[model samples]
Target: MNAVNWGILATGRIAGTFAAALRELPDARLLAVGSRTAESAEAFAGENGAIRAYGGYADLMSDEDVDVIYIATPHPMHHANTIACLEHGKPVLCEKPMAINQREVREMVEVARQRDLFLMEAMWTRCLPVIRRVGEWIEEGKIGEVRMLSAAFGYRTGWDPAGRLLNPGLGGGALLDVGVYPVALAHMVFGGEPTGVDAAAHIGATGVDEQTAMTLTFAGGGLAQLACAVRTNLNQDARIDGTNGHIDIPIFWRASTATLHVEGEAATVINEPSGYHFEAAEVMDCLRAGRRQSSLMPLDETAAIAHTMDRVRSAIGLRYPMDA
Candidate 1:
């Protein structure tokens, strides 16, 4: 197909963002949208300029014109939704954290592989131009043998016991909600699972972690200190310290600028567009190329990150209702 026909499986905030980004790509068509209700689906389709709207996910799935589906459902629903799309012979770009745990991620990956269909965790940061530059800087030895990393992603959402950010049924918590950013960053820089993980969390009255801190020790002696909180405000900055100097990324998750500090040299700034279109472009390219997974954000990497999150949750004694 010269142009990819996209189907959005949710009408939430993230789904809107993905739909808007898809509009920025010339080879992408926002063909269909689906929601739990016909009204919601029609509203989203009208707002996003989709050609068709379905009251239920199955209806959208049955639309053979949709070449791929973007699963923007909450974390708790990722497994079922992704599997459903793959089973229908439709490729998927599921939002992260791909699922609530590693086991679910593995199952999703297995289905994609078995069906020879495309499936990717929509960790948009992994496809950002600034992040690609960071990778290149690391490879060029600009940060000479990275030794330490520090990052945090947090916002002052206050406390809402029944809200999605604190609801156990929705897999709500700072870790899964925002903490995945720093953890994914660590993996991108360090390149694998940590040798050891030490963590602690503040489980609020809602039975979800309001704030959590972790220290990941890599096999090569590198360390990453990361934190995420839902009830507090944080710098939301990231730094990579190396033998020579450090690289600082402000608002790291969706960073547009990164500054590299080399020993006794002036800081150099790298900048790029901080939009979701890069990931969408990557998805279209992968589809056109007939690839099942992204090299930059592989399924194995997605599962490994889920494993790391599981370890963090274990260390903090945070259990979701779905874990049982």
Candidate 2:
């Protein structure tokens, strides 16, 4: 039996979740943790029982014992941080919205290809058992050819204009933050970027979108209506309507469960594991097989989703402060 040594970079809320999930996988070890400040790194490491705490990113990448590094940094920092890890001959699993733009995605993929290291986006929702059931139902023709998809994910976050939610410098806004969930779902289930993009947004004083609504028209005439806002509350349900039947997912973005309702008969429910364990289990399984990337959450899928999201951002005139 082989074990995978994991190094985690970042010390935020999501990073903590990732660390906790990795701890549950016996075949995977939380070998080290890195943060901008050694104090935070030490704190996170102590909390998670990680073996080592690095003062900075370089230390984690150079620690030799780490077989993989999870890049859970902010959206704007993903490309740079991921490249640094790959340069150290470490595989990376970056969190979603891989970057603020497609150009950055290209750069990240380029570095990984150049180094021949495995790289993946932490689009964990796609790999969950519940979402897998949703996809399976579609494949089984439980839902006829997908005709329409609608999803809404939004919450009123009253963060200052310079905070993560409203700041342009932080790649802020509802779109890149919460909206990516709905967008990724549409792309993962429907396949490919939409043919047409139409959008309306409530732009904040900080030049970031506070609320956005978009309609994506696919080549087959199917439509996806996506709405995300930082100014309102939403139920965050996702529904896929087809010619025969429709499947609905509640709390769809982070869905731990889903229901398949066919044209007739009773609806079937699929439940999944808790939190980030689903993705962590996948990482451990891949590591045991000596594989770099998970077959379920490959880097290519992440890049494709990023590309579609790039287009969506353009159609809606959403630009980050880092945009050149």
Candidate 3:
């Protein structure tokens, strides 16, 4: 099989991590890196071993050899960047919180569908082996009717009004940055939009949420209590409780192991590699199969999760400048 030529559309930290993960895959090649300046693009290219570097996003979009473009820009840039790639007839794997709002996500997905181009939200957690095993266990009735889930992701950070974590203009907030993990996991395990969502947030002086909590109730009476914060250190753990047993997933976002506790049986611990290669491989597989979206992380599910987030924001009155 021919190697997939990957073009990275930003020089941020996440972009570098993804480049490293791509290098670990034999069927992938880092073809190009793009940034707002020639110097930054050249530097990223040098570090990532890319064959070429472009001074601007448009240049990267026009590159003929790039089989897929990874939009690793901040949350607010995802919609516009993904749209540009799809317009150029290039497949895209956009970073998480796919867009600032569900409206933008719908537009991005619509463009990809109209152009018959592959597009996927780069929610690596969905593609990880341990998370997939969680899904499998649920399907096999090992968990026996999952009824509740609890997840929390948080970390204390010093105040920086202009930084990505606190800036309203950058779509900064705990919800979009880290809350999406627990939200998406709930959607993945519960399997639909919540019937009701109740949330509260601590809107900081920067006009962005510093912390948030949510209670989601599914139609089938399943419940999920989730929390995310940028002002406190949280356990960053997750659990799924069922009629028969529960699964404990520590550091659930990028978890490599999970312990299953059956009602009256010895616990089983499952393990896998902790890396982003699985999601990259999934994107390549979709491209090779001529599929427009991943079955594992479908566009509809992405939009649904975004809509749920919009609801949470609405309930908490957390409006970004972009919403104005």
What lDDT does the true structure give each of the candidates? 0.94, 0.84, 0.94
Q: Mind giving the per-residue lDDT tens digits that candidate 2 earns over 1-324?
A: 466788999999899989888877777789999999999999999999899999999999999889899988879999899999999999888887888887898899889888877887888888788888788888888888999999999999876987877888888888888888898888867877778888888888989888889898898899999999987998799999998889889889788777777777788887877478777767667766767677776667677777777777787788776678
What is candidate 1's lDDT per residue for 156-251, written digit by digit as tens? 895677878999889989999999999999998998998899999999888899999999999889999999999999989999999998999999
Task: Tell me the alpha-carbon RMSD of every candidate.
Answer: 0.9, 1.6, 0.8
Q: What pairs collide in candidate 1?
A: none
| Best-first order by lDDT | 3, 1, 2
Query: Residue 85 of candidate 2: its Cα lDDT?
Result: 93
Pick the winner on lDDT between candidates 1 and 3: 3
TM-score of 3: 0.99
For model 3, residues 12-49, the per-residue Cα lDDT tens digits are 99999999999999999999999999999999999989
TM-score of 1: 0.98
> How well does each candidate superpose onto the true structure, as a TM-score?
0.98, 0.95, 0.99
- lDDT, residue 7, model 1: 98
User: What's model 1's lDDT at 153?
Assistant: 98
Look at candidate 2 and tell me the lDDT of residue 144: 87
Q: List residue ranges in candidate 1 displaced over 4 A.
A: none
**Worst 10-residue lDDT window, candidate 2:** 283-292
